[model samples]
Target: YQNDIGQREAERGHLARELHDNALHQLLMLKRSVEEPTAALEFPAAYELLVADLRQIISDLRPATLNYGLRPALDGLVDALSGRDENGPAISLDVSGAGESYGPEVDLHAYRIVQQACENALEHAHPRILTIRGRLEPDLIELTVEDDGQGFDVDAQLDLAKLVAHKHFGLAGLYERAAIIGAELQIDSAPGRGTGVRLTWHSRDK
Candidate 1:
């Protein structure tokens, strides 16, 4: 599944680049070369909106920062999701230890897990603070996404039938991603307490 996801992301990236370099560029050129500027003002305005929408789509399909590494990709995720609403949670990321390469596939899966955790928190928990922490060692990589919000029953949510019935795939996806990358995933949450997701991957296991 991870391999399939990676392939899809690659295809999405290619499509995004093509649209940006060819179609979007041509649209821009056409807007600039318009013979009647006043008559085609609406065209320019519409073209700008189109460009912005297309870029956002491209970014959603596959973030470019993932090419650098997991940390930057997570940073981009936090930045994009944070500070959007005044009442939204404050998101922060702290990464320490040796900056080691854990292969692109592993990094991508880890990023997705973190992304899902954050999204779930924001959508359901309504947390005031969301913290993502990463630790990279020579043989082990650990990541934790914690939120100070109204938590849920972890055991009930982890059940497959219950998850499917409720259409809650956030935790399921995190588990799947962690399993795909051979990482140990732990979820801690309670009624009035907060929620925390920790993933630990060992290079030796891989």
Candidate 2:
């Protein structure tokens, strides 16, 4: 399952790279071309917004940072989001258990799970503070994304997550990803205590 997911991710990354280098560049050039001094009031602005959305989709489809090791990839994730809005949820990244490295598949899935969790926090939770924690233990690797935001009803959301694509939730996808890697997932949230998503897989699972 890990191998299959890895291959799919690789293909998505390749396609993302191509779109970014070819199609996205063309869009940029077109935007520049339409930026005439007397162009319509909304054309340039709308096109510019479209270009930005394309870039974000490319990034989300497959994170380029995962090409590096997991720690740096995690760093890249934080770096990409940290400066996007000065007033947006402040973020911090902490990595512990020095000199321990999981295999590539573990890193890949874990990275993605954390990334999605953060996106959920930012988009749904409306968090004021976001944090990612990575801890590599002798027997297990744990990754956590926690937030300070308006929490939700975990029971209802988890039920809805199980129904994704129809009545689904974003965390539903994360649950499947965790399953593929043999990781146990825990979601803790309430009305005001914020949300925390934790994924832990045994080292032997690698």
Best-fitting candidate, measured by lDDT?
1
lDDT tens digits by residue: candidate 2, 81-137: 898898898899987864244666777788888887998899888888899987867
Compare the candidates by TM-score and give the number of the best one. Answer: 1
Candidate 1, run of 10 with poorest lDDT: 2-11
Segments of candidate 1 deviating more than 4 angstroms: 1-39, 98-100
Worst 10 residues of 2 by lDDT: 160-169
TM-score of each: 0.76, 0.70
Clashing pairs in 1: none
Backbone clashes (count) for model 2: 1
Cα lDDT of candidate 1 equals: 0.78
